[model samples]
Target: MSSLRLVPGTPDAVLSALTAVLDGRGTPFAPVPADPAAAARVRQAAAPDEPLEHDCAVVLTTSGSSGEPKGVLLSRDALIASATATHDRLGGPGQWLLPMKPYFVGGLQILTRSVVAGLAPVVAGDSFTEAARRLTGPRRYTAMVPTQLARYLDTDLDALRSFDAIIIGGAATPAPLKARSAEAGVTAIPAYGMTETGSGCVYAGEPLDGTSVALDDGRILIKGTTLFSGYRLRPELTAEVLRDGWFRTQDRGEFMDGRLRVIGRVDDVVISGGVNVTLPTVQARLLEHPRVKDAVVLGVPDTEWGTRVVAFVIGDPGRDELRDHVAETLPRTWAPRAVIRLDALPMLASGKIDRQRLLEELR
Candidate 1:
């Protein structure tokens, strides 16, 4: 029986524990946040008394956006496979800049890649520019969400461009943001993957080496060495998603020009006014508006429409104007019927919109 340890989820602590686990010198551990509530949840999920399976390296939890977060178990082999594939895609790893919290897959993979490269990662401390200066590698890489890129572009263009490539995941990169990154010569690569795939296996719409992607009725199915072993203590849940060598993902995707184009989540589509509407389409249209900086579109339960299309927006855009803007490209019924303007969207610690919080506002 493999013992599980609950390591404190600090960059140094988690990194140290992870290093030991990867080196086969320590017990299988779960990194728990220092925050009381979050730590409790992680501890409960990990359940250290329950022995882990063979070769389990580290266990990480999901963002728990929809509901209860599940613990994802990853073996040392899977972690090494992911790091090797990432290095192959990124012109061989030199050194990584750790900008995100270490507990999440994106940040964890940065450390993993650095380990595989036999190079120490430069943690992007309070100052990104200072951290960029410390990257002594021939090839530099970092991972961040869309929000961080926008902020860095506004303040530190040179530092942002210092890296050979920047991996953007955890959320959709707005079209405007993508254009800005390109214009700034930032070499931002949009990645698509989740905790299940052990971080991103696809970058810039291309699957990395040792990773295979297929579509099942428009749903994205991934099969590769980068896949996680199973959900810790959740056998039934593991069997539900992992079939054969393929792991089923909930995101909808399409092959466009021989590249995997992730449309959105499977549940992003909702029937409003008896017409099916994809919320991301409406969200994208709102983002294209000059006056709108950001937007989140959601379908809410309503008596009249069965499901009402609602939008939470940032920037100074009028509800009617935004609705008309969406209608210009999409069907009139697909446009958000209700629009709530906000100064800024609430974000999770993982750099994703707190969508469940947005739904709470409706209640």
Candidate 2:
């Protein structure tokens, strides 16, 4: 038996040990005692009976921006299934590099796939130059958020080309970014899904192999082996999201050309002047503008309408020009009634746009 250190009752310690054991590194954990006498006693006696047998595994905590964060259990089998589907879709698991942190599900998935594919993942330390150095060889695969991809596109087109495929997720990929990245031979695949679904189930607007998607009253629903068992210690919440073996994703989506296109959150849609406006769809169109770097659309209260469309933008462009641009693309009524410029958009710890904070700022 391989001797390994384990700290008794702490969740992080137990989780770390589980990751190590599942990675096939060692067994018969020897946990280092904590300084506190009471905690030390608990650690000395605490040992998980469940044996870790999968490839590499980690528990992901939900962002909990709307409520409390809940841990989702994931096994090696589920992770491998996700990776296998991705590899099958993308051809093969090439050399992997990650600019994202390893703690989140997206970051952890990259490492898990690297371990499963028997390739060491190159991790960037505080700089893209270090990550670019690791991409020196032939074709490589990496996962990045849209913001990171945009920065790379603005600065390092050559480094971006080194990637065989760049999986863009964690938020909607602006149309301009998608078009630019594809033109540069980056093979960017815009993905959609969450921690409960083991990262991404939809790639480039299509559901992955072994994944099924449906819309219940406009709410996106996913059914697959990759779905997590349930939220830890939140049976009521679990029951709310899961139904009939399908996970009812809070995102609202529509089917077009046999592909699922996520519009926005069901609750994010608002009625303005008796017309329903989907913020994400409007934001997508706003992002298509050449001068716009990032954009977010939200609903603000109004007496004339139940809610009025408001847009917050990061790029420096004339409000009239943006309004005209939206008029040309979307319905004039759907165009934002008010436009505000923001220096930067708030982001959650998971690298997703903080919708709650945006709403708060709007209020």
Candidate 3:
């Protein structure tokens, strides 16, 4: 067994070590190796005299949800705990297919799990069929964002069901997509978590083994052994989010039927006439409509009410009829005051709804 440690070093060293490991070559395991003579330097320079921890093995970059990247320190134990929990939840680890890049935390988790599970992950290229063929045997797993899942749905159902379970994360999966996936015999688990929580603490709709979830001031708080130590060199930020050993995620969620349902970012909510409106909830409901293929909701400036709830939908339907359809099921206030029909909804590179871009287009 190789002992891992965190050492203060440069990106070249870190990359070299990663390359070595990926190529089956051995390298020193340290959180930050201080010696310039070491095989490789850390990705980020470390202070020579700074206090360094030896147990941390993985350094994850924040998702930049709040517009700035932060480094998350993770110990080997934490990463293993997360992978083990996922394996247990999925009923044993098998072959994994990576349709996404490994530089991301989600992708890294898949690669790490493959290594931990003693299996090599198949990287999908131009051929989806080739990827499906690699997923041989009884158990198979893959991780994809909602957009990828949607795109896969547009492809072949047989290829989509090739996996035993597909963990969907990186964004809120609309209810319609989840339903369609189940109908297609694909086990699509909508995951909720951030880099601070070591990928996803909640899977399907429940917290993984040993992970605890609670709400503090409408913000979801997660506490678990898998939680990252803190943002690297940003004590103020780390203190702001981490309190009482719980990571305060910006996301707001509710617990229903013993499962967690993430509503949206707390800031994503808009208040109109003193009524709080969750954009994601409205979009989710809109997606439930038979004609709507995709939907995104945002708040637009309104003179009468502080902000008006506006929705951009990708589908063909009369605005009144769609409004009535939404009003019939959801609360009247939750219904979008204005529906902007669009050929398609804007998406981020991570496959999330680009609300900022949509708002710009609407304006």
Candidate 4:
């Protein structure tokens, strides 16, 4: 049986312990924040008293945006497969700039890839720009979510262009953001995948080596050696997703020019006035508007409409004007019924919009 070790969630500790695990020199580890409440939850989920499956090499906690924490079980073989495939797809591994925390799969993969390439990753300093300037490599790569990418574009275009490639994932990439990234001399590759698939198996709408993507009723299904073993102690949930080695992702996707294009989460759709509205579709339109900087489209409870479309915007834009912008291309019902202006949207540690927090705001 494998043993479990709990450590502080700080990047340094997490990376040191992760290196030991990946090198097969120590027990599987789980990261817990220093906060009492968060640490308690992580401790309970880690189940220190229970022995893990022999093949399990790491126990990663999910963001748990919807509910309780879940520990994802990933094996060393799977991690090696992912590292190999990533290097093969990227033309070879050189050096990686680590800008994200190691608790998540993406950050963990960065560390793992560096180890596989026999090079140490350059952890970003206090500022992303400063850390980027410190990097030295013939081929350097890094990953960022949409929010971080936007911040870099606005604040440090030089830092963004310093890397050979920057991968964006964790949420949908707006069309405007992609275009802006390209215009700024950034080789930004929009990736698609999740923790269960062991990070991004698809880069820039193409599957990496050893990764296969298929569409099931518009939902994305992934088959690859990088897939996780299962959810810790959640056999039923694992059974629901992993069927015959193909993991059923909850995100909807489509094929354009023989490349996979992720639409949005399956549950992101809402019925407003008895008409279905895809939040991504509405959000893409909102992003096209010049006045709107960043926006999130969500559904709120409504009596007249099954669910009312609401938009939270970062910039100063009139509700009517943004609504009309969306209506110009989409159906009138798809336009946001209400808009809330915020100085900045609540973000998770991984730089994703905290959708559950936004729902609580409505409540």
Candidate 5:
């Protein structure tokens, strides 16, 4: 049996090691996270066993926003398929920008796609916006989560528009952000997928070629050539998610005009006074307020209402005004009972909002 390889280094070194594995020259690698605890969690979960699949090429660590980190096993064929389909969907292979860390699947895909295209991806150092300004290419592309994109909206419109395509994932891209990108003539694509489905099998609410998407009672189920084999060292967790060739996502989705629309996570719903409140819908309404830059709605324990809908907002909107805003769009009970003001939401290294951390803050 081949030994499991652990790689630790800067972004460039990580990309280089990932490329070597993709090129069938190096040992299967598990990219290390910057956080010591996260890195150790990945290493613990990535320990090799006799039942491990021989074809595994990469072991990716999930962001663990919802739970414990699990190493996702990606075979060579799956990685290739994901890269091929992404290029095919985006017109063709081109130069890429590495604005995020290479440990996550999104950043790793940038390296893999660049290797397949025989192009060197531009690595951002210290200042991503500055690096983006210096890049010169005919067909340039990059992938970033909403947090990174949010930081560049006003000052980097020109830099953003320079790219042929900007792939946005890791979290839900707000409607306002999408509008701003469209108005600026930036070809921004919102992707929906997790570490389990390679990088992203669905772009802009549409499944890519060679990928199948369906809604099973509001939960999103995806099956594709790019799907990971399974979770490393967690057969029970893998069995719970992957069944009958379909990966059951925690997110809820809907179909409209033959396109998929992500509704939110199944765990995002909470009962308030015997009525189900969807956090995403409430958060969307909160974002509609001009003063509110970003918002995360969650259910906090309340003895009176079972679970009261509470919102963490990043703007200066008044409690009454924000409550009235939600009440206008949704039922009164759905409005957040309380609003907690934050300068900025805590973010994971992957640029996703740290929901678990926010819950801890409440406790």
Candidate 6:
């Protein structure tokens, strides 16, 4: 049995190894960030010496937002399929900009897409304009989390409009940002997928060409060539999710007008004051306010309410105003009971909202 290898090298170095792996010339490996703290969680989940699965191209370590971290094993074929389909969906192959960390699937897919497109990726180092200037391809693209895109929309419109398409993944984007992007002539594509699906298989509410999205009792079920092979050295856990070629997602969504509408995770609902409050719904409503930049709605333990709904936000929206905002579209009981304002939302290396850290803040 061949052991899994770990690559904690610089971007250029990791890209070299990744190129070989995708070409079937190198062994199976996991690319981790160079930052000690960010890379530490990946190190704990990646069993470098453990036996690797056959034909495994990359093992992406996930911090599991809520649960323990796990290594998601993806094959070379799946990664290539996802990249190629992404190019097809976006009109054609083009150069990509790597704005996020190089290790996670969101950033890793940018590198993979570049390799598939036969173009070198331009790394966006602090300045979006500098990176946009480096793009030599006729068609240009980049992927960003909601937070990064929100910042760019406020600071740089010319740079944001330079790209043909900007894939927004990592977390639920604020409604205000979407309106601003559209009004500013920036084509921001909302993406959905996790490391287990070889990055975003569904872009802007539709499944990519080789991917299929179905509803399993209102739960999201995806299957296709872009799917991960299994979890690294954890077949039992892998069996729990991947069944009969379909990967069960924790999210519950519905399709209206042929486009998938994600309705938050299955466990996203909490009973507060004898009412079912969907956290994402409340969070989405909070984000619609023009003054609100970003928001995260969560349910905490409570003796009276069973689970007290709280809103941790970054912006100038007051408690009463936010509560009134939710009551406008949603039930009045769905409003968050407590409001906690923060300078910025906690983010993980993968560009996902660090829910664990946010929960820690409440403690």
Candidates' lDDT values, in order? Answer: 0.89, 0.73, 0.73, 0.84, 0.86, 0.87
**TM-score per candidate, in order?**
0.98, 0.82, 0.82, 0.96, 0.96, 0.96
Q: Candidate 2 vs candidate 6: which has greater lDDT? A: 6
lDDT of 2 at 67: 57
Worst 10 residues of 5 by lDDT: 46-55
Clashing pairs in 6: none
Residue 46 alpha-carbon offset, candidate 2, angstroms: 17
Residue-wise lDDT of candidate 5 within 177-219, one digit each (tens)? 8987888788999999888999988999889889999888899
Q: Which regions of candidate 3 deviate over 4 angstroms? A: 1-55
Worst 10 residues of 2 by lDDT: 47-56
Residue-level lDDT of model 1, residues 163-260, one tens digit each, is 89999999989999999899989999999998888899999999989899999999999999989998888889889999998999989999999999
Candidate 2 C-alpha lDDT tens digits along 1-363: 222234442324544554565576634342332446433332333223434222224445565655555556565567778888888888877667877755467876776667667666677666665676776434478888888888888777887786778898888787787888878787789999888888988998898898899988998999987787665445688789988989998788889998888887878878999998877778888888888888888888899888989888998887788888988978888888888888999986568878688877765
Off by over 4 Å in 1: none
Give the Cα-based TM-score of candidate 5 against the true structure: 0.96
lDDT accuracy of residue 119 in candidate 1: 90
**For model 1, which pairs clash?**
none
Candidate 1: residue 119 Cα off by (Å): 1.1
Model 4: how far residue 2 lies from native, Å: 1.2
C-alpha RMSD values across all candidates: 1.1, 6.3, 6.1, 1.5, 1.6, 1.4
In model 4, the number of clashes is 0
Least well predicted 10-residue stretch by lDDT in candidate 3: 39-48
Stronger candidate by lDDT (4 vs 6): 6
